[model samples]
Target: MLPEVPTEGRIPFLDLTIPIHWENHAILMFGIWFVLVPFAIMVVRFGKGKPTTYGIPRGTPKWAFPEVCWALHFYGLYTAILLALAGAGFAMLLTGGFSGSLHAWFGVGTIGLGVLQIISAQFRGSHGGRKAPTSDPDDRTTWGGDHFDMTPQRWWFEAWHKTAGYFALFLAGGAVATGLSQFWVLGIAIALAVVVIGGLITAVVLQGRGYNHDTYLSVYGTHPDHPFNRRRFAQMLEEKDRKP
Candidate 1:
């Protein structure tokens, strides 16, 4: 089990070079971005593999973007744009343009972006928990949706979620690095810890479910709905071969 966090007090080993004055805001933003956002992504990626997993339908495009590919491309793009704008403000602050007005604008804008991240993550997770009919109009499959699972949907879905989890390291690493340099390391630390903890938990859960990496890859080796794709199909075949 993960160690129980003591209270809301400061974490140990705060030796990173950040100033404590801006601690709360920095940590708060990092939490929403690093933890909340990726959790939504994992939910969408993993739960959407089946028609009724989580709550999304079999054909739901929970993990898809623009009704086509991975949803990350869409949200990540929007997030990058917002952060770039914030970075511009940061540059202004760093380069003699930080008037009281400028500081107010950038600070408010940064917090607003953080708020947006949390909201978007919430919406994404909610989308994954969809227990709706497959034939619903909204259940239309896009390109990626079509590829969601033809074979053992759960197997590939787990792989996809884990891959996404690994990919998160890059974004979280950058958040930590940039935040630390700007004297806001606590935020990144929290975000990184969340990512690590979440991934390990999911991995353990999958093992409990009797999934291993090789079995996972084989399920998605080609069309998703083949022999390895459908658990029911595999079990039924096994039953059929047994003599009466």
Candidate 2:
């Protein structure tokens, strides 16, 4: 039987009438975003680099396809799990509606953006070029006899998916900061420190090995028009020779 305080004037810092249930929600949110999401991203980022450990040459685009597919599959599964946890947390918040509060709405927005990210992934298929094909069962290549065609729709989906991910991270940080503006000083500090350290490590690893999507594109092809596409390299070379 919590006190019936109306959602309107219950800003976490200003109101200072925190209930146990709200505190529970804050802890749940923190754990899901700070710990779980980052860990999943780290695993996908770093795990993709480990194909070299299994004898696949580093920076070889064709060899990396299977690893990239597996990484996306793992991330998609992780996103679904995070959505479920976020849904449960939001359900608890709805018991006493979070009307007119930045923290609540920001949290809701993060969840929505995350859902969009998952949907975007469903459309991520590799635009294929006519290259040497392998018979590996693990390779789920999107390329076929399309004559070096680049699917703009798939590229747009990937771009939006990445944009939504960045927004989700920003909203999660804002929600956590506002939610704990005036309470649990020590716990919040420790939790933030952990998150920052983990983030730095992930950044270093991603920078060292390279971002997965960009690396794949660089090795594969930007599009049929771009000079980087393998199909165009020979054409560019011939044009260069003819110029002088």
Candidate 3:
């Protein structure tokens, strides 16, 4: 278990870059880009896997991914807020308004992109006829809805979301590099971390993009009449053999 954080003597956000609060800055920076961002991507990736062993007919995509996405969105949202707040704190402490550093600009860009992402999600509706039918009582695919955006708009939304995500991740890396420049982080270490993190995010996002309706339903079709049920089909075959 993690050690309990002491309530008293907590370093104020404005003191984030002070020598005494270096650890706080390090922790916050790592928490946002490394932990939260990767966790969100992994959770969505996990939804693309088969869940036959668990007997979850809807698989992780239908039942678990949305729930995870909902929870992780808060992480992304608040982290973006914290990034802005930290910048504002720094400005208040020293710069009086905004630091003209490239890092500061990148941080601002990240927050702006995150806000755009959130707004785009609000307009998202079903993707063409791709939405899971609600007429069936057993329908369990739960991510999009029947009222979702049109294909062309959804396509643009996806394009923007993916592009912005990558840009934000890169900007976060730049921000961390600048933020930690006075610290012990080596140049080589930063480079390696960026490459590894960027590669992983790219891979996971690509994998998620490949999980179209056919791919998803093939692995975990929950519809009552879907032909994807191998076990049920086998049983039916066995019963038919016995009947004659």
TM-score per prediction, in order, is: 0.36, 0.61, 0.54
lDDT tens per residue, model 3, 19-58: 3344455566666666677556544544344433313333
- Put the candidates in TM-score order, highest first: 2, 3, 1
Query: Model 1, range 137-201, lDDT digits (tens) per residue?
Result: 34334212222333334444444544544444455455445545555455466657767787779
The better-scoring model by lDDT among 2 and 3 is 2
For model 2, the run of ten residues with the poorest summed lDDT: 49-58
Global lDDT of each candidate:
0.44, 0.56, 0.52
* lDDT score at residue 201, model 2, on the 0-100 scale: 80
Candidate 3 structure, TM-score to reference: 0.54
TM-score-wise, the better of 1 and 3 is 3
Please report, as a residue range, the 10-residue window in candidate 1 with the lowest summed lDDT.
Answer: 1-10
Query: What residue pairs are clashing in model 3?
Result: 125-148, 125-149, 126-148
Model 1 TM-score (2 dp): 0.36
**Relative to the unseen true structure, what is the C-alpha lDDT of residue 68 in candidate 1, on a scale of 0 to 100?**
34
Backbone clashes in model 1: 11
Query: Model 2, residue 21: displacement in angstroms?
Result: 3.5
